[model samples]
Target chain A: MFRSLLFVPGNNPSMLQNADIFMSDAIIFDLEDSVNLDEKDNARNLVETYLLTTKELPKAVVLRINPVNSDLVDDDLKLLQTRKIDYLLLPKANKISLFVLDKILKKIENKIELKPTKVICLIEETKSVIDIYELAKHERVEALMLGAEDLTSELEINRTTEGKELLYSRSRIIYAAISNKLIPIDTPFTDIDNQDGLIQDCKNALNLGMKAKTAIHPSQLETINEIFSPSQKAIKWAEAVLKKAKELNKGAFQFEGKMIDRPVLEKAKKIIEKAKLFELM
Target chain B: MWQAGSKESNDCLITLKKSDKTKIKIDSIVGHLFHNQILNAVKDTLKSDNINNVEVLVEDKGALDYTIRARLKVAIKRMMKDV
Candidate 1:
């Protein structure tokens, strides 16, 4: 349901309240890289108060806490326990093996003193993408986010308009996320003003199996939502597939001269769900 | 110059006239509106039991009015605990 997760900087107060007006399914109140080290405490304090006191937010509110090893992370975790945030977003989470992930879950539990059932919004940098399958297998992970900026920085490769550089990473993320039954969210398009670029990038990611995308600016939210949602054509195709499958009455059928089977039907159902999400009838 | 004035407990002043004086002055009405919302959100602390005076100044960067508001809210929320 969280097709668009917008990043509203934790230190920016007006952005937080304004975020509520959007139709995005999730809001990432960033307290990590978006915040300066000197402002971490201030950002954390504000985020806590906003969630507690502000007008009711519409979507799932998630706090991207500082890294686990950072001194700031302790206070971030402590503060989350007192807030209405739905997820404790963990960043720089590269190389998350089974044992390491379990350790993080345990630390979060101890720090926040929450149950093990509490899940993590896991963002994967380069090293983490290398071990994606193992990380996603952990029960504590709720969603897998591609941290392209960090990964690109780590790999020392420039990200192009086409996002061809991160294709492997994107594929790995989808594999892991699908295996874990978790949503795979793509990174934001850095060029805020390039609407056409954003649209194409979103389509590419959606085509590659990203269930949702993160938006850096509010202006980008509308387009991301539009590009990912099932279009009229997609809805028609899904409906046609369902109808064709029903007519066949067999497990396997044919559509557009291609084989349609149980898996195809499932995909069609997902498309239908997306259409519903878009209110496209 | 940025002015700080409080009319009510929940309302406070937060001004940010461009610190960089080299920049040209803006007369656009829309520009002011962008910073105004930011100032109101950050300085007001709407959830406070008390509502009072408010003022704020913002140095614009050709940003939309909404961006101004969002940034200001974070600043005010950060300072809320101390207030």
Candidate 2:
């Protein structure tokens, strides 16, 4: 249900305090990359305290821990054992990483009597993109997030404004996620000031079947939410198709010179359902 | 001396020093209303950590119980590491 997941630096008190007020569907309190090596302990303590003490929370709370190979991963998991985190955004994720994380989570769940925190595998490395489907189908994985910036660096290519370099990886992730019934999250648009570019990027991702997108800044949430939600034109078409189907009361019929069948009707129903879910109906 | 946290809004800067007797000083924007609550947070954290002799100075900018406790915990850890 997340159209936008905003990353908030874990060590910033002001951002952590105001995380829930943002319009993003989820808050990703980032402990890796955003926090420096010296501030890792500080960030971990801050996030733990905030999550434990805050009475009100956003719809979803995701903690982006360091990679599985890092020493900080164990401490990060141990600290949040008693807290209510919805997802763990595992960076540099691969089959081995997922397996290791799954085992650790199982141990923590068994010991603390806590529910399993779903995982969102971050596909950034070239090796991961090659085995995206296996990572998506992992039992603990609920989503697959494309990390285009890291991927481009690994590919030894320059990422462009048009995102031509990311098309292959993006499509692979989307297909893998969709096949596994997991959410596919597009990468954040790096240029915050370029709203037009952001819109186009989101549209391209959506058209390719990405279910959601991550945002580095709060300002991008509005555009991402709007772009991902069911459009008014689609809703209207769905409603009309359903109305005609009801009137005709047949297995297949002609509507506006196009044949209407069960698949079309089901697609229309899904659109209407999504529109209702997003409160656009 | 060991310190953690910052002067940012909704955060508290905690400084710790080795001392013969435990002393906690709290300076907060919301001290007038939450002075005792802030004091309790410091005392509770110190007690839980079994810290008997340390000088704790909390410079708070409207931090909640959790922020104060967390800052204090980090400071205590740093102080203990040096010990």
Candidate 3:
């Protein structure tokens, strides 16, 4: 249901205060890259305090903590011990890091008598791309995100708006996410000023099976949400497919030269659910 | 005391230095309209944290009261953590 996740710098108090007003499906309070090294503690304190004091936040609140090897992950997880955060965005995620994080989360959950927090793994490095299948198998993994900025930097390649270089990686991410029933989230379009470029990028991601996208600026949220929402034509097609499948009561059938089966029905159901959630119905 | 917070645009950067004389000095730069509102909130947070002797300088960029309070609280907490 998270079509657009808006990232607000954790250290920016003004932005953090007005975070809920943005029209994003979720708000990510970022404590990693966007924050300065000296201000990590400051950002953590600010985010923790806000979560503790705020009466009611409008959308789901996700906290993007520092990387696993940064020696700050423990403190970041500690904030979740008492707070009611929706998800944890683990940057530079890998199999071992996810395993270690899962253990830590379990221990914290047991100690504090709290529910387990869902996690979104950020695949940022080439090495992580290799182990995505293994990483996605973890029980707590709810989504897989492609961090193209870091991946391109790690691979020592120039990034292009066409995204030809990331095709393989995007496909691998989609495969891992889908095979494991996790949501696939695309990377942010870095150029904030170019709306046309953003739309094209979103279309590319949509074709590759990404259900949601990340937003570095609030301005991109509307476009991302709109692009990811199910269209009226799509909803009607899905509804027709479901009705035809139910009427036939067959395992597989032909309709308009396309095969309809359990998998197609499942996909159609998800589309209808998303359309309803988007109020397209 | 130790300095904390950022001076980024639209953020309140609070620099707190410990002082030997048991006195609290306040200085700030904010939008002309909410100057007093931010000032009172910062001073009240300092008192609540029992920060009696410190030099506080605030470089605010149109921040609200809660923001000012959050920044000052972090600065004070970092100072206390060091002590």
Candidate 4:
């Protein structure tokens, strides 16, 4: 149910204190790329302490830990064993990395009384894009996030504002995620100052069936949330369609000179459900 | 000598030095209101870790109890490594 997931550097006390205050649905306490090697231990300790002591938290608390192969992964998993984390965003995720992480999570679950943390697999490499369906089917994977910056670098192409280069990968990811009934999160728009660009980017992702989006800065949350939310017109149409169906009491009917069948009715029902979940109704 | 944390707002810089007896000094922006609480945070962390015979200097910028404890824990671990 995360329309917007904001990234917060794990070691910054100022940001950590206000993590839940932002309007974003979830906060990703980043312990990977945002943290330097020298400050890895400091970030881990800081995030752990924050989680343990903070009584009020955001709707969802996600931790983007170091890569699965890194030595820091062991310490990163320790948080799951002791603290309350909702999701683990695995960077540079692949089959081997997911296998290793699943095994580790299993071990932790056996030793503790805690529920297993959900996983969000970051799709950045070509191999990952190719194997996305399999990755999406993983029992622990709840979402699939497209990391455009890293994926572009791997492809040796400059990512343009038009995002033509990412169309194929984005489509594949969206399809796989939807087919598996998982949430597909779009990459963050890096240009913090360009509100117009952010709006267009969010629209493009939404049109392609992306359910959620990531935000590098808090400023982008408003636009992302607005674009991804079910529009007022759509909600009204859905409500009208449901009313007509109830009145007709028929499998197939005519509404506004268009054929309304079971599939269309189901789609209308889904829109109303989304509107209610997002508090738009 | 070992140190952890930073001088940023809502954070504290902790410095540790080997000594004959344990001593703690706190210099914080919110010292007037939370001086004893800050001292207890440091003492409780040290006691829980079974650390003694060290000098701790906390330069705090309104850090909370958990933050102070985290910084002190890292400082203790680094200091013990050299000992």
Candidate 5:
């Protein structure tokens, strides 16, 4: 359901304070990958203020903390115990056993003394691709973000402006996320100047049943959000399908003079679901 | 801190400067940033208390320590009260 998630470097207090103005569907305060090793602590402390002082933050707030294997993971979870942190975004998560996730979940629950419901896992490695279905099945997992940087590292493939190299991994992610009813967020398009590349990636994600994507810069958010959203034509088609289904008294039917089977029907339903996010339906 | 475990260091950076009724600078903070996780801890500390700010700056490494935030807030509050 997150139509756009922007990653602001965890160290930048200004970006954290003003993140709401951009109005992305979600904001990722990155403590991994983006931050220098020396500045991680300062970055984390700065985020705490942003989390506390702001009201009605324009979107869902997710903290992109370092991987569980990293040195700071324990302290990060400990601090989150009493604070009103949102998603626990674990990056570089590959081949995770339920034990690992459950352990982390327990730690968070004990600290904040709250039930564990929110978690976003980054699927960024080839090993993760094999275990994606199982990873998606984890009850606490609500969203799966495609982390191309690591994906490229694991696969030994380079990403191109056209995004052709990511096709297989992208497809597998969609299949896995959709099967588990979890939201799939696409990888960031690093070539910020290539407007055409971002648009193509968003279109591909949309075609594959993805609902959102990550952005490295604020400027990329607009194109990604717009492209991934339901088109007016799509919204109209969804309305027509539902109307026709109601009239025919059947779950399966035809639309646009073609058979609209379950898959097609579900696709149509998704259109409405996504459209509802923008209040179009 | 932003991550899970570490008792070795404070995860944040803290500074106290007299307003001197001078305009606050945006770019840098004078107090040194502790190694690695210190910056994150300071930033995370922001949630624990309120800040009135003379001026505060944080550079994230990989960890956000809570003490960093707490120190900054206490410093800011003290500065605000003195005014």
Candidate 6:
């Protein structure tokens, strides 16, 4: 239920400690792209030390590690051998890469006698799109994020705020994640200055049935969380539906000239649950 | 020893040069206002990492204790090239 996942640069100590103030649903300690090439070890060590010392991290903690093919991946995994990380985000994830990562994680878990760490895949390449179903089927896979920046770069297409270039990929990801029961997280808007564009983009993602998005800056967290959380109107509708469902007691019913069936009931209940979780109820 | 990090707002520049007789010498360019806060933390971290003999030069740019400690560890590791 991570509506907004904030990416905090692993190498930036101020940003790492700033997690206490930001209200992102989840915080991704990025050791991949955010860390400079020579400072990979430094970033990994910093994150490990932070986790070991910090007492109360409000948001869900995720570690975005280097790609499977990179030389730094081993040391990155070594950090997990001793630290408690809730999730491991594999950058540029594909079928082959995930298989390799799965093996590595398994070995680490065995050596450390630690519990399984949930896995998240970054779907940003065309090859990954072709094999997304397989990638989503990983036992540890719990979520998938669309990395539009890298995806567009690979496709040699320009990304637009309107999101025309990412329609197909977005749709495919939503479908795959839904079918596999994985959470679908959208990419960051990348335009830190244009608040209006970010709002429009988030609304579009919500319309496309995405439940979460990554935030590069903390300012975007509020907008993303507000968009993804169940609105008051939605909560009211859910409450009304529950009341009517209890009254009906059995079978489908007609409400507002629309069919109120089991699926609709389930959606209403989920909306209410989300509202309660966010303490909006 | 070796050096790591930069003089960025949230970072520190640590220079670890080899020393003799297992003696530790620490000099700071911006450790006055905080008194012995940054240097003390760096010293503790160095001891915990089993680094006893080195000349530690710290150029603090308002880095947190964690940043300063991490920079020192990297500098020592690069210097030793053993761990």
Q: Which candidate's lDDT is highest?
A: 4
Against the true structure, what is each candidate's TM-score? 0.73, 0.93, 0.88, 0.96, 0.76, 0.94
> Which pairs clash (backbone N, Cα, C closer than 3 Å) in model 4?
none
Q: After superposition, how far is residue A40 of candidate 2 from its true place, in Å?
A: 1.5
Write model 2 residue lDDT over A1-281, tens digit each, in one string: 67899999998888888888998889999999999987788888989988988988878999999988989999889666646799999999998999999988899898888887899999999999999988987888999999998999988998776888899999999899988889999999999999999998998899888989999998999999999888899999999999999998999999889999999999999889888877898
Write the residue-wise lDDT of candidate 2 on B1-83 in tens digits: 99999998888999999899999899999999999999999999999999998899999999878888988988888888889
Note the clash tally of each candidate: 27, 0, 0, 0, 51, 0
DockQ for model 2 equals 0.76
Error of 4 at A48 (Å): 1.0
Give the range of the ten consecutive residues with the poorest summed lDDT in model 5 chain A: A92-101
Pick by TM-score: 2 or 3, better one: 2
lDDT of 4 at A84: 73
For model 1 the interface RMSD, in Å, equals: 10.4
- Identify the superior model by lDDT, candidate 3 or candidate 6: 6
TM value for model 2? 0.93
In model 3, the runs with Cα more than 4 Å from the true position are A240-264, B7-9, B19-50, B55-59
Question: What is each predicted model's overall lDDT from 0 to 1?
Answer: 0.69, 0.90, 0.85, 0.92, 0.69, 0.86
Tens digit per residue, CA lDDT, model 3, A259-281: 98899999899999999887889
Task: Please give the lDDT score at residue B28 for candidate 2.
Answer: 95
Superposition TM-score, candidate 5 onto the true structure: 0.76
Provide chain B's TM-score, model 5. 0.35
Number of residue pairs clashing in candidate 1, backbone atoms closer than 3 angstroms, sequence gap of 3 or more or interchain: 27
- Minimal lDDT window, size 10, model 6 chain A: A50-59
Q: Which ten residues in a row have the lowest lDDT in candidate 6 chain B?
A: B21-30
